[model samples]
Target: MLLKVALLFAMLIQIGAAIIAVSLIRRTRFNGSWILISGGFVLMAIRRLFDFSTLFGNAPVFQKEEVNSWLGIFISILIFVGLIYIREIFNLRDRIDELRKENESAVLSAVIQAEEKARQKFARDLHDGLGPVLSSIKMGLSAIDLQSLDQQNKLIVQRSTSATDQAIVSLKEISNQLSPHLLQNFGLTTAIESFEDQLLGNSDIRFQFEATIGGDRFSYQVEITLYRIVSELINNSLKHGRPTLIQLSLSQQTDMLCLTYNENGQGFEPDQLSEHQGMGLENIRSRVKSMKGIFQLESAPGKGIHVTIQVPAK
Candidate 1:
């Protein structure tokens, strides 16, 4: 009787644990290892139920000495198999996670490379094609002998020249925004400061930019990646948030570069990142992932927004 009670208690515990394991695996994302782990737990639970039945119930297999020996051996074999599977599940899960990250990183890198190539092509067209034509137009207008023309004609020419000048300026600015040469020549710090100046002039925002990395330059890819990231963050702040001040700081440690950005504006809930899917946010994250970097965001309504990024420099 005591043995039967113990067997029943063991069976109940195994069933409870199996249920919990199944519940967890069901709620989680599906994968082979998860299924295998869940199956192993379930097998252990069923084996316990069989043990209870063999000990308590009048089963013919338990009644015969030789048959009982074979039944115990079969049960032992299943228990060993289940344990082996459960043990291997850890290694399988880790391998799957590593492969997933590698796959994601490769996809993002390809997309970013394609984007950079397109930007380079567009910038070249603006700088080489439209830029020269606009400059010539400005020069031709200047060479026009306005004194020979009637007063009304001279006013028209002057206005046309002024509009042409503005157009040329806009073209240069837009081209630079696409891909800045300063980043490759001067370094990350100069490129970022120039961007801040542009944003400062175009909007009612104060930018405080600082860099402690000196004038040391990184590879063109890294420089451009960081530049685009910072530029986008500032653009988002200006476009979405009613902010007065935006602050950015950069520093470098051994093999790692860190950027910290803050905006004093109407911020959103931090949890929204998990609950909501925002393209702008996703773009930022994808860029960081391609750089093999870490991105973090902190925000709350009516308070402010803070972002910290760390990327490998080497």
Candidate 2:
């Protein structure tokens, strides 16, 4: 009977040691629950050793067999409870990560929608405020040309007319930049081609464009967001990169649409910039997130920059 008790105690000690070792290894990184689990296993091991030693060594122990059995059962319950808690901790961590991703996506969508609304408002204001004012100035100048005005007054009118024309042209450019009319009339491809042509005519930098868009038509919001993102990237390259060559490409495969750009210019570390800090970069990310898309940037000092965006066609 004593030998059987010793063997059973040895088995329990081995199981307890294994549990303690696992818990200690898991707690090496300072996890509190693992430490607690290890403590529970240690207590069970000590209780089993005492019970076996008293049975084998002819010691007159105070505790009865029933009391020792109850104690063992209690420690076993504690170990089982600790394991359940550890499982719950892991599950909670996974849920927190998922929630964080969802929250980020929500915030990005809100920002992009807000920016689009602001752009539309600015376009409307320019049309309503400056467009009519310039038109009136032109009419006034034409009326003066038909009147018997002095030479000096005629020159003043001519100068005023020239100034008004210049103002009108500036306003038109601003309106177009805010929201292109070609995007509404033609399509994303035509609007992009027009942008490329305009950039080539205005800048010394070489511009290259390649597109293989196969979609029938995209929503206005999608087209505007994409156009704004591309335009911002071009502007950034011009102002900061000072690249001699710029390449823009677009394509679609299955349900995924892709836009990529590369510039041979001085580039900076992308990791150092905050997502919501740079206006251009922020807008690009916002637009991508709004479309439930992925945005990636590859850049290093003096190496150049490459941006790739992919979105599902809906």
Clash number by candidate, in order: 0, 0
Of candidate 2, the 10-residue stretch with the lowest lDDT total is 58-67
Q: Candidate 1 at 228: error in angstroms? A: 0.9
Can you tell me which runs of candidate 2 are displaced by over 4 Å? Answer: 1-39, 42-45, 48-56, 59-81, 271-279
Please report, in order, the local distance difference test score of every candidate based on alpha carbons: 0.82, 0.80
- Indicate the residue-level lDDT of 225 in model 1: 85
| Quality of model 2 by C-alpha lDDT | 0.80
* Prediction 1 TM-score vs. true: 0.77
**Candidate whose TM-score is highest:** 1
Model 1, residue 26: distance off in Å is 18
